[model samples]
Target: MLIGKIENWTKERNYAHPVIRRAIDFLDETDFSLLEDGKYPIWGDDMYARIMTIDAKPRAEQSAEKHERFLDIHYLLNGEETIGWQSLACGAEPVRPYEEEQDYALYGALSEESLQAMKPGMYMVLLPDDIHRPGLSETGASVIRKVVVKVDKELL
Candidate 1:
């Protein structure tokens, strides 16, 4: 997992894959305000971005999920949210088996977890091995607008 301000992308570019760098560049140059909520293709199915407007939920109501086929770049566009993350190697039991069609598996409560407070312009990169629970609030539920860029694992 990686978290940083999009504005400082240049410094981090060296550490990212070329495809990921391209996605970051596209996000850096695009005007998200002009884009509506939905999936937008960038490089066919290999890469895409989805604009989402979601309501924050409590920790108990949210579930930790991990994707096997893609890495998620969670970018905050408006409002704030708290996302919990735990390493898949930490021994958290899966609540359900992975759904190949959806590329995700839900996990039960994590015995070890870390939280990240994300505000507008900040982004978090979640790899396939990272179990993340997004759209949570530190105080209480609130609405937030964000974009998720999905890059195929093969691209990395």
Candidate 2:
């Protein structure tokens, strides 16, 4: 698992080492007590920067469509979460929106070779082209702390 501050991630590229190191540092310095609420804190113009409190209960399985314009820098604040990831290389079919409230739509089923497990303090940065399924269960339910920082495709 990785933990760190967002400001220290300034020099990050595609590799995970430096970014992961910075995340660890960030977690050590910040007071995450304000994250008890399920609401996300507002940050940036297009970036989704908020502390996510995932409950220790099973969550609805869902995959986010491959985004054309952002990178997802998800940092787990607490507990553990196993996120499912799929590759766009296999080709994806579009689907209807699952929850209009969240503006997230489900993508087509993926080949089994693409899933990944993410635990507490560990983070994953989903590139603009990566298809991801976040918030799943392992041991019943677990609360996960996360922050999603979106990077514009133009910068990548």
Candidate 3:
């Protein structure tokens, strides 16, 4: 997992993958206010962005999830949020089965969960091995706007 502020991407480190760079660039260049909640292609089916405005629930009310085929890039646009992450090796049981069409699967609490409070310009790059519980609030349910960019592993 890679976490950093969107504005710091150009200086913190050099990114080599074009797909990864494009995903970051998309976040930097796009005016999210002009977009509605939906998926938009960044590089055809190989990469896409999902935009949403959600009223986040507490961590207890949510389940962590992982993707099999794509790595996720999440950018927090507004509001405060706490995201939980843990190692896939932690042996947590899945609360729900994997759905191939959606490339999604849900898991219950892990052996060691780490919490991250996202700032407005913060972004996270979660890989297939990353088990993350998003859309959760620090204290209680709250509204937040974010964009998640999904990039196929083939492009990595």
Candidate 4:
């Protein structure tokens, strides 16, 4: 997992991962206000960005999830969000089986879980091995708008 500010990424464009660098470029170049809430293709099926608004809830109300085929860049647009994350290596039982079509799996409580406070200027990169629960409320904020860019693991 990686956490970074949009400004920092702009200043330091030489990210080690080419795909992640392209994802950051997508965020940096687009005018998000012009687009509606939906999926937008970047590099066809291998990469796309989903823009949506979610009602932030408490962390306990959410389930930790990890992806198999795709990695995610959770780029915040507006409002505050708190995300709980832990390594899948920490060991947790899956509450639901993995759905290959969706590339997601839900897990119960995770060990060594920690929270990350997210704001509009920041983005988090979540890998296949990262168990994450996003959009948890921060300071009682209700709504959060974010662009989740999904990149196929094959691109790594």
* Candidate 1 vs candidate 2, TM-score winner: 1
Deviation of model 3 at 19, angstroms: 1.8
lDDT for model 3 comes to: 0.89
lDDT of every predicted structure (CA atoms): 0.91, 0.56, 0.89, 0.90
RMSD of each: 1.0, 5.4, 1.2, 1.0
Residue 83 of model 2, lDDT score: 70
TM-score of 4: 0.96
Tens digit per residue, CA lDDT, model 4, 17-134 = 8888998899988999999999999999999999999999887788889999999999999999988999988877689989999899998788789999998979999999999999
Model 3 regions more than 4 Å off: none
- Residue range 42-69, candidate 2, lDDT tens digits: 3344433556665643434554465665
The candidate that wins on lDDT is 1
What residue pairs are clashing in model 4? none
Worst ten-residue run, lDDT, model 4?
7-16
Report how far off residue 101 is in candidate 2 (Å).
12
Please provide, for model 1 over 31-144, each residue's C-alpha lDDT reduced to its tens digit, 9 standing for 90 to 100. Answer: 999989999999999999999999988899999999999999999999999999999999887898899999999986899989999989898989999999999988887999
Give each model's clash number.
0, 15, 0, 0
Model 1, residue pairs in steric clash = none
Reference-based TM-score, model 1: 0.96
